[model samples]
Target: MIEYDSYGRMKYDPQLHFNQGKTWVDEDIDYLIHWLEIIGYEEMSLALGRTEATVRDKVFKLRKKGLMKEGDKSKRHRKLLGRCKDEQAVNY
Candidate 1:
């Protein structure tokens, strides 16, 4: 679903368009990766306007940089698995 303006107009927001395989700057990546340590992937994706895979990739990069811990073997212990990637990202 699209976003409805205050007056109820559905304006086409450019951000809703999921630019897959897009390149990101280090600033956005670093900030998101920092939060990724504290938040789940899906929520972090929403906050950073990226896909869950993008957030995962960021986390993986953090692991490579020694910023985050390695080892996520079980979804059984995963946090916030109930939440999903935002509908806007899915719409793309």
Candidate 2:
């Protein structure tokens, strides 16, 4: 479940913390990055069942680890889509 502050920003829900670093299937992570790119942070948070900060943090971490490109739109889209497609192919 999600908790929201009075200002409507997603609040850090302790219950959701366990979902972090828990190893999403590649399709899930790809879907996350794709949604973040298309719809932006707030909606991404909803889709990810995470706080907006967590969404931003995860994306940043992915970039830091070189799993995602920082600013190259085409590269980002390809990487993200490729991840999803790979997962689908492998039935993961």
Candidate 1: misplaced stretches above 4 Å? Answer: 1-19, 71-92
Each model's lDDT: 0.55, 0.59
Q: Could you tell me the lDDT of residue 40 within candidate 2? A: 66
Model 1, span 39-72: residue lDDT tens = 6565565666665655667677878988767654
Tell how far residue 50 is off in model 1, in angstroms: 1.4
- Relative to the unseen true structure, what is the C-alpha lDDT of residue 19 in candidate 2, on a scale of 0 to 100? 61
Q: Give the 10-residue window scoring lowest on summed lDDT in candidate 2.
A: 77-86
Per-candidate clashes come to 0, 0
TM of each candidate vs. truth: 0.48, 0.53
Summarize candidate 2's per-residue lDDT along 48-86 as a digit string, tens digits.
666767777788988888887665455332221122322
